[model samples]
Target chain A: MSATAVLRVDNLESYYGPIQAIRGVSLEVREGQLVTVLGANGAGKTTLLKTISGVMDPEKGTVKLEGTEIQGNEPDRIVARGMVHVPEGREIFPLLTVAENIAMGAYTRSDKAAINADEEMVYSYFPILKERMTQAAGTLSGGQQQMLAIGRGLMAKPHIMLLDEPSLGLSPLLTEEIFDIIRRLNTEQHVTMMLVEQNAAVALDVATYGYVMELGRIVMADEAATLAASKDVQEFYLGISQDENQRGQRRWKQRKTWR
Target chain B: MDFVQLIVSGLANGCVYGLIALGFVLIYKATEAVNFAQGDFMMIGAFVCLGLTNADFMGLNFWLAVPLAMVIMAALGYLFDWGVLRHMFGQSQVSIVILTIALGFILRFAAGTIWSHEPVSLETPFAGQDLRFGGVVLGIDEIAIIVVTVVLTGSLFVFFSKTKLGVAMQAASQNQLAAYYMGIPVKRIQSLVWALSGAVAAVAGILFASKGAIDPSSGLLGIKAFAAAAIGGFGSLPGALVGGLIIGLVEPLSARFAPDGFAGIARIAPYAILLIVLIFRPGGIFSQTQKKKV
Candidate 1:
C-alpha cells in the first residue's frame, strides 16, 4: 500500500476474435514488491500480461507505466519505458548466440558504458551464460534457457519485469533455483515484478502479494501468506485437504476449474 | 586461353547473379516473402544509372551515378515496404508472392515507357580497358565485378556479426515476436532489410549495365538469380552466392563441351540444376526452417 505503484492497470479488457479474453482486470504492482498472478490454463492469465506489455491491444482499459498512459503504445515503446516482458514459453531468439540475444534486450538504450555494466550484472546472476557466451541460445537446456530469458530481460535495466510462466516446464529443483533468483532480483536489486504462473505453490512462496484469476476475472486477492493459508487455495490450488469432511468434495472439485 | 577467358567471363556473370540472389535472400530472410519484382528493381536501378550518366542526360561521373542510383532504389525499396508490404504481414506467403509478381509487371511497363525497350550500352571509364596476364586477358569490368562482389559480401557478413542494428536485423529475421520483446522495431527493421536488398540490386544492375547491353527486359535475369537463391537455400545469404557461382560456372562449361546435338542446353542449365536440388534437397542447401512457436 505504501511504496507507490510503478505499473498500474485500470479496467483493462482484451479480446481474441469475437470472444472476450480478459475482462476489466485491474491490478497494481508497487515499487520494490514481487507480485504473482495465479490462474488455471485458460483463465486469461497470459492475455492480461500481453495487454499490459502492449503485445495485445486493450480495447477499453488504461495502462499507466510510471504515470504515463501507454494503452495505445507499441510493445517496443513500452519496453523502452522500462517494463520488460519475459514472455511465455521463453521466446529467446534461437538462431542468435547467447551474448547477442542478451545484447538485443538493451536495444533501445544507447549508453555504451551502462549497457556493458548491465550485461556483466546479468552474467553475475546466470554464470552458466558467461561460460557459453557465444553458444546459440537454442542449445541450452530448458532450465538454462529459462535463466537466459530472465537474464536477457535484466539487460533492459527495467523498472518492473513481467514474467510469464517461468516454471512452465522445469523440474521442481530447477523451478526452485529460478524462483530463488526471481526473489533475489526483487529484494536485492529493488526491481518490481509481476509474475504470471500456474504453479501456485512456488509462485506464492516468492510473491509478496497474490491475485487468483479464474476465467477472465480475479476471484481472490490478498497478501501471499494469507492466500497460501486460505482453505479454498489449500484445497483447490495446493491440493492439500486437511479436513476429512472436505476430502471427498476436494476430489470432486479437483476436476472442476475455479469458479 | 579461350577456356581461361570463359572462366573469367563466367565468374563475372556469376557475380551479377550472386548479387541479385543476395537481394532475394536478404528480403526472404527478413520477411519470408518472395520478391518476384527484385529483378524489376534491378532494371529500375540500371535505368536510373543510365539517366544520370548518359552524355545527353545529367552526365554525372560513373562512380557518382552508381551511388546516386543505389540511394534512389533504396528509398524506393523502403517506401515499398512501408507503404505496401507492411500490410501483408499476416497474409499467407502465396498472397505476397502473387502480389510481388504483379508488382514486377507494373515495374516493367513503367520502365518500358520511361526508358524504352531498346537495348542501350552504359558508358563507363574502363569499358574498353583490359589487363593481360600470362595467357589470359581480363576486362576491367570483369575485374571490377569480382572485386566488388567479394568486398560487398565480406562487409555485409561483418555488419551482421558486429554491428548492433545488423545483429538486431538477424534476430528479427529469426524471430519477429521475440525481437519485439527485446525492444527492436520489427517493422522498421524489415523496411531496412528491403532498403538493403534494393541497394544490392542496384550494384548488380550497374555492374551488369557497364559490362554489356541492358534494356527493360534485363530484369528477367532475376529468374536465374531466383534459381540461384533456391539452390543456396532461401534463408542463407552466402549459400545464395555459392549457388549463383555454381550456375555461373556450369553455364560456360555446358556451352563449351555439350555435344552438337544439344546445342541449346546452356540456356536451360540453371533451371536443370534447380530441378536436381529440389528433388534431392527439399529446402535448398542452406535451408532454414521457421522458428518453433510456443
Candidate 2:
C-alpha cells in the first residue's frame, strides 16, 4: 500500500432523524489497498458506507475522494466521479436483463469500445453471467445476484469501491468463492476497496488492514494480521473463547472493556 | 355488411380511447400516479388545435396546426411536472391521485373560460369523405384514426426496446434509487415521460375531433378509457390498446343487437366487463404478480 490515501473520511457523523447512526467516525484507505470494516448488526457499518457513497448525508464530515471534497454530492454525480457503491441487499435492477443492468453501471461513460471490453472482462470473472446475460436479474440465485452486483460495480471502472456485506445471504462455499474474487481483484487488478462485513475471519484473511466498529464508533483499527491474532478479537469476533464453558460470559466482559 | 361497418367504426373509436388510456398507463408506469387530468389534456389538445386552425387566430392549415398543438401540449406536460408534480415527491399514492383530480377540475374550468361551453366541429380535409368497398362503407377519418394508432403504438414499442433513454426510463421505473446510483437522472426521466404522454393525448384528441363535434363534456370519454386500462392490465402498453378495442366492440355490438329494454346496456357495457375481469384477475389481463426477495 502507498502513503497516498485514495479515500479519506474525517469526523463523519450521520443520523436517521434525531437518532445518530454514525458518530465521529474517521478512516482511510490508501492506494491499491483492501481495507475491511468488521462489525455486527447495528454497529453502523452500513451507515458508514451509505454516508461515504452519498446515499445518506452526514451531519458533520468531509469525504475526500483523491483529496477532493465529495460530501453531500448527488449519488449519480458521486458515481460519475469514479467511486462506485455496491449497497447492501444486492439491490440489482430486478426487472432488467443482466446485460442491461451491467450496461446501466456504465451509463456515465460515453466510450462504446471501452464499455464493451469492460463487459467482456466482467464475463471472464463469472462465466455464468454470460449464459444468463439476457435473463432478468431477479431470476438469478443469491450467489449469482451478488456476482452481478459486483460485476455492475466493476463496469463503472471505478477508482475505489465501497462494498456493504458481500457475504450477506450466502452459503459458506459461496462466501469463500466471492472472497477469492475480491482478493484477486485487489491483488491482480489493483482495485482499491473498502469492504463492510460481518464475517470477520474471511474479511481479515483477504484484507491488509481492518477496523472494528461498535455502537457507531471505531473500537479498534490495526493491521489485519495483528488484529486477527489479538486475544480480544479471537475471543469475541472469531468466536474462539479460551474456555469452552465461558463463551457467552467472555462476550459480555469484552463489550464492557472495549467500550 | 352492416355488421362489418359497425366493427370498422367501433375499432376506430376504440383506437382513440386506447390512445387516451395509454397516457394513463405511461404516467402510472413511470411515476405510479393515476393522472386524473389526462382527459383534460385531451380536451385541451382538441381546443388548442381548433384555435390554431381558426381563420381569426393562428390561421394555420389543419396539417400544420395539429403538430403545433402537439408540441404545445408536450411543453405543458413538462411544465406540469416542473411546477407541480415535482414537489409532490414522496407523497402517498391516494394524495397524488386526489391532487391530479383537483388539477383536472382546474384545467376543465380554464378550458371552459377560454373556449366557452358551446360545441364545435374540428374541420379536416377528410372529415366528410367516405370510401366504399363492395357493400360496406368506411369513413376516411375513421381509417386515419386506425392508421395513426397503429403507427404510434409501433413507434412506442420500438422506442422502449431500442433506445438508451427509453431503457433508462424503464430502469428508473423499476427502482429509482438503484437507477440513481447507476448515474441515471430519475427526476428528468419522469418529466420526459409526462411529455411523451401529453403528445400521445394530443394525437388522440385530434383524431376524436375529426370524427365528430366536440364539447367541454367530451372529456368524460376518458372514463371509458380508464375502464379499458383496467381490463387490459393498467401497466401494459399493448394491454391498453387491446382493452380499448374490446370496450369499443362491446358497446356498439350490444346497442345494435340487444332487445328493446337491453339497449341501455351499451352505456354500462365497458364498466361491466371491467368489473368481471377484475373479479378474476385483479392485476388486469396482462400484468404479472411481482415477486420481491427478502
Question: Residues A116-169, candidate 1, lDDT per residue (tens digit)?
Answer: 999998999999999989998888888888999999999999999999999988
Winner by TM-score: 1
Candidate 2, B239-264: lDDT as tens digits: 89989999988999999998998899
> Relative to the unseen true structure, what is the C-alpha lDDT of residue B164 in candidate 1, on a scale of 0 to 100?
96
Q: Weakest 10 consecutive residues, lDDT, candidate 2 chain B?
A: B285-294
Worst 10 residues of 1 chain B by lDDT: B285-294
- Which regions in candidate 1 have their CA more than 4 angstroms from the true location? A246-259, B289-294
List runs of model 2 lying over 4 Å from the truth. Answer: A1-3, A243-252
Q: Candidate 1: which docking quality band? A: medium
Error of 1 at A108 (Å): 0.6
